[model samples]
Structures are given as C-alpha cells and as structure tokens.
Target: MTTGNIKPTKEKKSRKSKPVVNEKSPLLPTKHEEDAAGFDEFNGASFSGAVFNLSTTIVGAGIMALPATMKVLGLIPGIALIIFTAFLTDASIELLLRFSRSSKSVSYGGLMGDTFGKYGRMLLQICVLVNNVGVLIVYMIIIGDVLSGTTSSGIHHPGVLEGWFGVHWWNGRTSILLITTLAVFAPLASLKRIDSLKFTSALSVALAVVFLVITVGITVFKLFSGTVLMPRLFPDVHDLASFFKLFTVVPVLVTAYICHYNVHSIDNELEDNTQIKAVVRTSLTLCSSVYVMTSLFGFLLFGDGTLDDVLSNFDSNLGIPFGSMLNDAVRISYAAHLMLVFPIVFYPLRLNLDGLLFPSARPLTSDNARFALLSTSLIGLIFLGANFIPSIWDAFQFTGATAAVCIGFIFPAAVTLRLVNLISNLICHQLSFCHLKESRFQFSLK
Candidate 1:
C-alpha cells in the first residue's frame, strides 16, 4: 500500500464537546405508509363515519328552521335555489383540489395563503372565525331554548312548553347556557384529534336518518290516509321582483349545505389527496339528494308557506309521536354531536386566535389555557347575542352569504386555477431552459 500511495497521518481532535438536547421533541410518525391505506382508515373513520360527518356538518341546527327559509322563497323556486347552491358548492370543491395540489400544503388556510398571500389567509381566517363563532352562538341559543322550554318562534303554540320537563327552569336560560357550555366544552378541551369525533359524527348521521324516515314516513302515511291535504299547487308570480325576493332564502339554504371547511379535515386525514375529490363529490351528492328529498317532502307535507325551521309546520299538539320522537332523537344526537363538533370548530378558532394575539404560543397544550379561551369566547358570544336571538337567523344569513359562498364556491375555483397556473409555469420553465441550452451550443459551434 505504501508503494502505491502515500499514507495519511492521524488527526487531532478538538477539546470542545457537542451539546446534548435536554428536552426531547415529541416523536412524529415516520412513514407515509398509513396514508396509502383505505379511505376508511385515513381519517380514522369508516364509511359510516364519512356519511355521518357529511350529514351532521351539512344539517347542523339549521334544518329545524328550513321551513321558514322555504316559506320566503316559495316551493318551486326554493327547490331550484337549493339545486343552484349545490352546483355552486360542487364547483368550489373541484377548484379547491387543484389549489391544494399546487400549494403543496394541506388544509384550507395553506391553500388560501398560497393564492392571496397574507391578506388572503387573514380574510379566510376571519371568515372561518366568524362562521365558527356564529355556529357556537346558535348552539348556545338552541340549548337555551330547549332548556327554557321555548319552541322555535313559529312553532310557538301556547301550551307546547307547558308539558316539557324542564319548563320549571323557565327564567333560568343563563344557568342553562352555563351548564350546556360546560358540558360541551369539557370534552372538546380534552380532544386530541378533531377527527376522533367519528362516533358522535356517526350518531348524528343516524339521527338524521331516523328523522328522515319518520318525517317522510309520517308525511306519506298522512298523505295516503288523507288526514293532511296538500297545499296550493303553485303560487302566482306577479312580477320579477317577487321572483327576486326568493333570494331571501339563499342565506339559510347556503348555511345549511355549507361543508367546505370539512374538506380541509378530509384532506388532512386522507392517505392520498386524490381521494378527497371522491369523498367530497360523494358527500355533496349525498347531501344534495337528502336536501332535495327533504325539502320536497317538507313543502308538500306542510305546504309552501311553512316557517323557517320545519318544526313549526306541525300543530304543537299534533298527536304524532313522529314529531316528538324525532325531536328527542335529534336533541340527543346533536347534544352528543356538539361534544365532538365543538373541537372541529374550536381547532380552527384556536389557530386563528393564536395567530392574532399570542403569536409565539401557537400550539397550545395547556388544558387550562384552552378552557379559559373557550369560556371567554363563549361568554362573549352569549353576552353579545343573548338579547338578540330573534336576529340570529339574520346574522346566520349574512355569515353564510360571505363565508359559505366564498369558501364553498370562490376559494375552490381560485385554488384550482392557482394549481393549473403552477403546472404551466413549471413546464414553461423547463422548456425555456432546454431551448436556451440548445441555442448556446449552436452558437458556440458556429
């Protein structure tokens, strides 16, 4: 070896020692293998889980008030508007997929940041914050109503609250709110993953199915038995202004069907982002079918002039167990559901809040911190809107108009266009680089 090459000398080591990491960082899963698994396992959800998530998020507390929305728009046009909104919603989803791919980041906030920069992110975060807050307020109001024995406004028959068990707490809406808040927030505070809410999500879907069966079955039975006659066939459309007035229903329908935020969660859980397209398409199609069927059955059974929140259409003492049973079932389902759903809404809320005030403490782990934040937010919402329940629906409409339309429709398209643009730029850059190399070679040879 010495004959062929020179030997190397030993090197001296430095006196300094490397510093050791005192606090170990949490372990992150190493492999991407799990993501490639089945759609059912990606989000730690089954097929039923997907269905339940879709149904619960889409239905929410809004369904009870749908009759009032339909009443404003009339039957045919109301149905048409529902269809139109569905189309808008579908288009938005398709667009979001493209944007997600181009952005190369998971979740809606990331995609938004890629497209519109900081302002875009801020705007989207604000919209999400408002929507979540709106929903929380709505939930509180609902719990208050149920606890205080108040019927949905039009469902306000005189003796309806008299027979309810909790009617004794008639003036105790504040105590009711506090109790419900604690119940709803406690589990949410402990939840590690929002997606883990699959159980309650499934329960929500079951409740919807149960309600649907009862509502449709009872309506059909009533129709066949001739106990309840159908209402007017078609309302007279005097002018275009009357037709334009139908736009009033747009807010409620938009709010009811809004599930765009759910898409972000679906993507996060998905093994392959491509599956998101499938899930969203499937979910939207299912939701639209449900809405159309439910709306039609609702209008035909209760007639065109039904009030917002369909519960109002029936007589207070409507000797039907279907109504009462459905009410109790839904109450249970949603009550359980709020336990799960609250975290989904709260995660984004906390994210936004962290970004706004406590920039350094983004990933908050302290349970006390979470509890305090939630309590403050909930209390603030109640204080602002406690006396304004009558106008909550109106607020919902405005929130839906901005958040639902943009998040559901516009953002998706913008995202898709951004992805397509990225792909085109990448291709052009490669082609230009190749052409420049060729031109240089020819010039040198010449």
Candidate 2:
C-alpha cells in the first residue's frame, strides 16, 4: 500500500539490469520483506484487492466496440486473433515475473528502468500519461451520455454547490466533470494504497460479467427465436486481410490487462509470492474469458451494426423490455463504470508523471500539487478533445505499438538476458559462460 520509496537502481546504464540482491548492495530486504512490505497494516491485500486489480486492468471502453472489431476480423480469424493476443500477453506477464525474481523489484516502472534505463522509464511514463488521458476522454463521453439521458428522463440534472451558493445552476457537462472530480479523483488522490479500491474493482468486474451474460443471453435468444438478422456466424476468406487490421484492437485490451504496474502495491500486501501468481493468473483468465465470450456473442447477434452497448445493440424486432428503461440502465451502468475506472487510470497517470518529472515531490501530501497536476490535465482534456472522443480502436492501435508492445514484448526480453548474465557470471562461474551467450540468442528470437 505504501510504496516506501522503493526506487529502482540507477547505476546501470547498460541495457543490462543488475540483480537487486547482489553482494555489492546487501541491504535488500530479507525474502519475507522482499516478497511484501513488512508493515503490519499494509502487509498484504485481500482477495478483493486482487479481483479489483484484475478487473480494472481487464475492463476498458473497448467492450462497447468489440462487435465492430469482430465484424472487421470476421468469425474464425477474429477468435484466433483474440486468443493469440491473450497468449502473447500471458507470455509477457510470465517474463515480467521472471524479471521480478531476478531484480527483486515488483513495480512495472521500476522493472522497466532496471531492464532498459532512464530513457525507457521516460518512455513508460509517456505511455501511461497518454493512455490515462485516453481513458479520461472515454469517461468524459460516458458521463456526458449519462447526464444527457438522466436529464431527459423527467428528472432535473444535479446542480453543483446549490446549497453553498443558495441558487440552482445546471450544465450537464460541467456537472459531470464536477461530480467526477469530487466522487472519483478526490478519493483516488487521497489514497496511499492502490489496494484500497479493491472493492470497487471487484464490483466493476462483476458488473462487466453481468453485462456479458445478459448480452450472450440476448444473442442466443435472438438466434434461437429466428429473429437473428446479422450475416451468418461464419468466416469469409476475403476478410483475412481485415483480420490482421483488427490488431488495432490490441492496445486498449492490453491496457485493460496491465496489472504489472500495480504488482508492487499488491506484493507488499501478499504473504506468499506463489499465492500472488495464482491470484494474478486466475483473475486474468476469468477476465479474458468474460471479454472473449461477450465480444463473440455480441458480434454473432448484431453483426456489423452499431453496438454502442451490447444491451441496446439488439434489433427492434426482438422485443425485450421498455426501450427507455433499458437505454437508461445501460447509460447509467456505463457511467458508473467510467467513474469507478477513473481512479485506477488516474493514479497511474499521476504516479508516472511524478516519477519522471518530479521524482522527489509528494503530490499525495500537498493539495496544491494534486490540484495543479490533475486539474490542468482535466481542463486540457475538456478544452482539447472531450467533445470528440477519438476512436477507441485507433487509440488502442497507437498504444499497442508504443506502450503495450514495448512493455509487453521488448522489456521482458531485455530483462531475461540481463538475468541470465547475472546468474551465469555469479552462480555458475563458467569461463565460456554459455548461458550468458545463449541469453542474447533468446533475446534475438523474441
């Protein structure tokens, strides 16, 4: 929960990470302290924390557009692509764990710095900053939709500081931003531990699951009831090229899968490294399964048509419920999710910025620091791009190429080589150092 100034080593500029527990610097925590923080209060996170980290990492606004992604890739290839992406991501995660074992550091940014250098750390900072902004834009759009729908439903929009000002004022956009700032960012900023929000994270995952199940049910119902109107649920050879194009869908999904950054915080709370791995594996598997099923069924039912939300995407011919009520439900649920997700992304943005620019500053202790950084970011987003939220898929493509692939693919390979070199030179003492030589071989193949 409390990071406790666990800084990554800065002495190594070579693309080779020095193991953290080497004899030169033997002050590293014992195996128990290395596994987790030794503080009584912040020793380990609950199962709820694991679920929260997993769910928050996995769920993105991308679920809304998965139908479109599937349409682009077609059926069989689309499924294959998703599976392949999952496997690739899993491998990267395992490599990250191996790197953690070698370096004895748990944070993703720290691991990256250990593996690469100052430049790599800066690159990760930029990636997290951009990704966080993208997420903010999404929440803005989602909040706007919710506000619009709520105002239209024979209810007045919530006014800001009405009691303080002794007057009523209503602006949908401003209201949403104010509420988001107060309800989401305020709590997130005050928190010292990322694991504290595990409950909300678990709730979000559950909600996503419910949404998926409802979508699959609707899809199956539509199919069986003979009201299904989409193209046949089958692949077309002509769509093969487009299937590769669908790789654009990987970034945000990868972002949604990014749990490494928070691993340090989680590890501090965990007693057993094996338990942590088990939890991580279970959470990722469950989240991915839900996402894949939801995407597949939504596409099967709706085909290429617009599926802003899975529930509302169904055709008009298949009567299910009151249109207005369902629309409101979908909008409200989405809005709630966006709000819950804001902190998860926002804190990382704050941490990365602080780490890169003002590594010594404590934004947590200073109100001025928090407001200056967060408000400036939010205002810039509102002024620059809140009105036209960029395409999620396009954003994902850019993020995948820059952040996901680099962090997931390149960093892991680098660390593995560094670890092999450390082990071979120190433990085995082989004159030829065949293992060290083979490290580069694996890196090249990767």
Candidate 3:
C-alpha cells in the first residue's frame, strides 16, 4: 500500500483529572487545598464528634434569650416556631450541601464565590464577622451576668461570685470577664482546628443538660407542690404595636438556630463526609429538644417575671428547697458552658476575618502571627462590646435582623435562585429535599 493511503490517526490527548468531584460519586467531597492529605496533620473527625461540635455551635448564647421569645410569642407559638426553625435549618443545610457538591466548593465563602463572585464572598465574610462578633459579645455579656451579676429594672441580680465571696475588685464584672478571657477563652480560641474542640463541645453540651435538668426539677417540684400555674399558651395581642412586637421575637428565634455558618466547617472535618446530613439532623434534634424544654419550663418557672436573660430571673427566690443553691448552680453551670462554646463560635469568626483581610494569604493555622493578631484583636473588641452593651436582647436583635438573617437565609436563597434551572430535576426528584424550597418560601412570606 502507498504511504499516502494510510489515514492519519488523531492522537488522544492525555488530560489530567481536576480535583473537582461529581455529586453522583460516593465521596461527594469538596476539600480545601489546606485540607488535602499530607497538608494538615489531623485526620477527619468522627460522626459523634462532629455532632457535638455543631451542637455546641447551635446551642450557644441564643438559648438564654429563647425564654424571652416565649414571653413574647407564648409557649404554644414559641415551641412551634422552635421546631419549625429546626426543620428549616435542616432544609437550608441540605440545600447548602447540594449546591456545594454540584459546584465542588469547599467553604461557605468558596460557595459564595462560586455562586455570585468575589464580592459576594466578601459580603458573606463581613456578615459572618458581624454576626459571630455580636454572638460572642452576647456570650461575654451573659458570662458577666452570671458570674458578676447584672442590674436590670432597678433590681440587682447578684452573680454567683458576689453571693459566694461578696463583691471584690477581682470578682467584679470587669475583672471576672478579663480573667475568663485570659484563662478560658484565650486558650481554647487559640487552638487550630474545629475537631480539636470536640471534648470541650461534649463538656459544654453536658453542662447545658445540667441546666435543663435543674430547670425541669424546679418546675416539677413547684408544679406538684401547687405553687405554680401555667403561663399563657398563646401570645396576648391588644393593639397595633403589640402585634408588631410579635415580629420582634423573630430575631431571637432566628438567632437561637443560626448554626448555618459553621455547617461547612463541620462537614469538612467529618471522617465519613456523607454523614453530614445525619450529623445535622442529630444536632438539630438534640438542640431543638433542649430549646423547647428550656423555653417551656423556664417560662413556666418565671411566668410574667421572665427577664430578657432568663438567668437573671433565676436570681430571685424560687419557692423551693435550697432555692438559692439551685439558682447558683444553674447560672454557674451555664456560664461555664458558654466559656466552652466561645471557642466554637470564635473559630469561624477568626477564619472569616482572616479571609476578609487576607484572601490571597496562606491558611490561617499556618501563620502564627496572623492567627495571634486576629484572635487577640477579636477577643479585645468583643470584651469591649460586652462591657459597653446594655442589653442582650438589643444585640441579638441587631445581629439577627441584619447579619444573621443574611447569613442564615438570604445568601443561600440567592445562590439557589441563581442556578435553580441547573438542578431542578435533582431537587424535584427527592421529596425529602423539597423542604428547603418550601421552608424558604414560608420564611419569605413570614
């Protein structure tokens, strides 16, 4: 045969496999460069461990204000909203995971970048900074309230330290918060990874349980002793302004369940990454149970006397055995639990702040100077905010209405709306997954 008669073969180009993964595959993993194997020393976190961390994130500072919301919405509406928020949170997180998997995006900021642009991601970082800072400030304020006491409505609710040792310069609000900042918060926040706080998260959850058990005990004792009466099951609305006050309770409820910011971080660390859904369901179920019990019984115990910080209501004499002791126990245990929860919140705050300031820089844990500067600067700012802020309700409302709402609901909805056509079939096929669209729709109408 002549050489010219042989057809030229088109060579198959050898292509490299990109790191991006398809959702249909089993792993469904979208990891950051720093998270790749041999990059970080730590391995992935266990399912139980991830649940504890996420639960701590959800159950922080917000729980204190839930009873106040009950005062506004009443028990029936309050409990209903709480459960609804849990289901909604589960739905939102599911949407987040689905979008993340489709785009092969790892972090929340990264997901935003994929959906909107760099500016969108930057906006998310700013919102996170505002929300988490507001949250941590509330934590510090509650700690100050519990350990050093808060003065509200012409009544002085004495802190545990004051009751135990009387007020000293060292035991004053400023001193107690400073000492806690240096001793408890500083050490924990300085840690590098979310998974590292697993033990502390477990301890924090247990301490919350301690508070719940004590509240239930006191409520039951008073109920059985015929010393207590059920509070209003539905909110009382008399006038136009009174009706609007019901809307004010929305932020408190939103803040109570605003754990979306930490979802990606927790999912990234899970050893069995697909179990992220289960971890979320488990965490929300546990947290919603805790929130309901706390709201119902805390309101029952206090009734019309419930203060913005329910812990403040605990300062008064309960008609029970060793009432002061029980009061002290509840406040002290909760304060300590907040100390543990501080780092879980602080971890994401620091990460986002660093992302905002140093987008092109290396990983946060890799740079000692950047990590220290951000950590101290944030703690100092929050400490100042706690001291200056007059009310926890004000902080919760401000953060929840603005940053928390955006972080929790708006951005995710925007992301989904931007690309709804792409994955319409994927979402429509799974009836269980339809909750996100339904929940978000209900949320907007609300």
Candidate 4:
C-alpha cells in the first residue's frame, strides 16, 4: 500500500493504451482501448489511489454485518463464504471489464445499453440509485447511532457525546448528523473527481483497520485471560428450518461485494487503464483479508451475543481493562471511517443518476450547474431519509441487496454467457486486422 516511491508518470500521455500482451502481440488495445480518451482534467490517479477508492466501495455497511453473518454460518463456513464471495466478485468484475473493453462502453450503464437496450441501461441505473442511496442513508444512520445512541426495548444506550458531555440540543441525532454531513461529507462529495477522495479513502480504509486491530486485540486479551471461551466453528443446526436459514447469509455476502458499478469509473480514471485489473486484485485482496479477520475475531469476541449490527454490540462492557474506552474508540473510529467512505460512494451515485436522468446531456463534469443540482438533490434526499425515514432502512437494504445482486453477479454473468460467440468473433476480426496492419508496417520498412 506504500505509494511514496512508486510514482506514475503522466506528463507523456499516450493516445493509445499499450498492448496488453506485448508490442508485437495483437491481443489488446482492443477496439475500445484504442478509442479510449484521456481526461483533460487533473493527472490520472496513481495505482494506490484507484485501489483505495474501489476498496472503499466494496467495504461499506456490509463489513459491520459480516461478524453477525459469521455468528449464523460459523467460522469455518463463514470464512469459506467470504473467500468464495471474494472470488466470485473478482470474476464478476473481470467480466464487466472484459465486456466493457470489447463493447467500447465507458460506464456500467453504457455497457448495459450496448449489451442490451435502453431498458437494460435503465434497470442498472435504477439499481445503482437504490443501492448507493440506501447505503449512504444507512451510513448516516450508523453515524448517528455511534455519536448519538439508539434506543431499544425501552432502554437508551449512551453515545460517545451523550456519555461524556451529557445530552444537549446540539448532540441530538439530527443535529449531529447534519453537522457531520456539512463538515465531512459535503466537501468530499463536492469534489469533481473520484480520485480526489484518494487520501480520504486511504484514511477510511485505515480506520477500518483500526477497528479490526482493536477487535483482535480485545479478543486476544480475553483469550489469554481465559475469560471468553472458544466459540462454535460450525452452525448449530437442529430443525429443518434451521438448515434452510443458513442461506439467509447469502444476501449479506452478496451485498458485501456489490462494487461492480464503480469499477468502470475507477478504471476510467487510472493513469494506466491497463493496471485496472491489478488494482481490482489488490483491492479485493486487502478488503477480503480485512473482512476475514474481522469476521473471525469479531465472532470470537462477541460469540452468541453478536447483534445484527456489531457496532451496537460495542456499547456493552467488554470484560477487559479500559474496555469502555476501547469500545468508544472502535465505534468512533468506524464512524469516522464511514464519513470518509461517503464521498467515494456518492461519486458513482451522482454519475449514474445523472446518466439515468440526462442521458443526452453534456458530461457531468463539464456542466457545473447540473453537477451541483444532482449532488445537492442526492445529498438532501439522503439526509432527510437518514433523519425521517430510518424505519425503511431494513426494506431499503433488502431491495438494495436485490439490486446489488443484479449489478454485481447477475448482469455481468449474463453479458458474458449470452454473448460469448459474438465476443469471440469480434476478437478474431480484431486480431486479423492487427496482424495485417503489422505485416504492412514491416513491408513498408523493408
């Protein structure tokens, strides 16, 4: 992840991407890459920057739900599912990248529009709208949950501010979330580029690591002290219903990896688009590692006591010295992490929403007023939803999860399977053309 020494050169921009295999080879710089245009904006993002943005996309509220998933599926199956999902996610993204390059589409929506029709593009857009906005709203709610405690069973849990400074008008949920939106989310979201959030994305990933580190530390301490016993490594199944219930984690697993929408954007902005596949691999590797460790240690620490949202589980006494302080640290750090993640998610949401509504309009970046209108509208909608309609979060997550399945797994697989022969023929034609062009150049030199 260290990016200090490995500098990417951008001053000598190339009109065409380097061949994928070799200069003598005719496999890549496929029709799409040959026609790919460089952005005239700021220099493209360094490799690490792209990795951070994409990793942020993949690791959202879903990470908090992973520990709970492990509780249901057990460590063995749980870890297996995580790894398997990561692989599937990798393949799905690969499909999107491959088909996108072959089809000459720049965005996910465009790819869909190319592969299918306008209706297909519209479907992907709607799904992204639901998924990203729901995720952003839930992020706001989680922040509120951390900074201003939530109530359940007629008991009110204390938030960091409430516990420390006592409840005040300023520390109320709406007040705190509003301040957070203005102070953190607004400026980051306002940036015109996804790579602009690179540093914040890196920090966000670091905060996630902070949470993971603390969780592992607490678990290790408890293990050595012989206070917390080893948890079950398999699901405790008895009834037929119990056996069927294990499938419920599928949604969580799928949602954990639904980042296909933003793949093209990141790839679009990379200094070298060819490195996008490597970026995907690195991001997935880093995120999946965090996910596996978090699931394992978090399940070990809380065991049966783990809640659907494990952040809530942090409110209780954790049977260690300075446990209360560590609890606050974990919650607050992750809250801040989500704050950073806001913009990375918001970027694609804005892009897709714009493309959905204004398909024929100029590029969003070139149209300042259009960009502002979309950004403000989306943020306002999310802010109001976080404060007013929090009850629908469950429903939103369900529908969003469904849409995410389509964006991540279903659509990519369909594009690949349905158009295999077409792509093969396209590749053959491109290859023959490349071979002929190479021969003419050689003959001319002779």
Top TM-score model: 3
Q: Per-residue alpha-carbon lDDT of model 1 for 1-446, expressed as tens digits?
A: 25657677545211122111100000110112211221222213344455556555676655655655556655677677777877887777667656555544445665676666657766776776677677666655554544354445444522223335434554366665566566666555455444566676666566656656666877787678776655544444589987776666666777777776666664554334445566766777776776777776776667654545454344343345566655555344444444455555555555555444453332344445754675466446644564467544766777777876676666667767666788899999999999999999999999
Best by lDDT: 3
In order, candidate lDDTs are 0.57, 0.57, 0.84, 0.80
Which digits, one per residue and each the tens of the lDDT, describe model 2 over residues 1-446? 77888887643222122122111011122233332432323244555576577567657565665666567656666566666766776777787776766676556666666656656667767776776666566556546544532222243332222312433345455565666666666666455456667777777776776666666666677688787676544444356685566565566456555555555445444534455566767766786787678678877766766444343343233355463444345445655776676666565666666556664443333445664665566545643455555344455566555765565566667777777777777766674587878998999999
Instruction: Tally clashing residue pairs in candidate 3.
Output: 0
lDDT over C-alpha atoms for residue 431 of model 3: 67
How much is the lDDT of residue 414 in candidate 3?
87
In candidate 1, residue 174 scores what lDDT? 67
lDDT of 3 by residue, 1-446 (tens): 57988888644211121121111111111134432422332346788998999999999988999998889998999999999988888888888889987876766777877677778878988999999999999999999999889999988988998988998999899999999999999999988777789999999999999999999999999999998877999999999998999998888888888888788777766665777899999999999999999999999998888999999888878979899999999998999999999999998888788767776666666778988999999999999999999889999999999998888888888889987965676667776567777998999999
The Cα error of candidate 3 at residue 298, in Å, is: 0.3
By summed lDDT, which 10 consecutive residues of candidate 4 come out lowest? 19-28
* Cα misplacement distance, residue 410 of candidate 2 (Å): 2.7
Q: What lDDT is obtained when candidate 2 is compared to the true structure?
A: 0.57
Model 1 stretches with alpha carbons more than 4 Å out: 1-51, 146-162, 165-167, 170-172, 231-236, 239-241, 271-274, 313-315, 319-342, 366-371, 378-387, 418-446
Q: Considering lDDT, which of the candidate structures 1 and 3 is the better prediction for this target? A: 3
TM-score of each: 0.76, 0.73, 0.87, 0.85
lDDT (10s digit) by residue, model 4, range 1-446? 88899978765432144311111011112124322433354446688998999999988888887898888889999999999999999998898889877776766776777677778877888888888888888788788888998875465667888988999999999999989988888888889766678999999999999999999999999999998868889998999998987877887788888888778777766768878899999999999999999999998898987766778788888889999999999999999999999998887788778767776555676778998899989999999988865432363357445887898888898788767967789999999999999999999999
- Residue pair clashes in candidate 2: 43-269, 44-269, 45-269, 57-256
Q: Model 3, residue 215: what's the lDDT?
A: 98
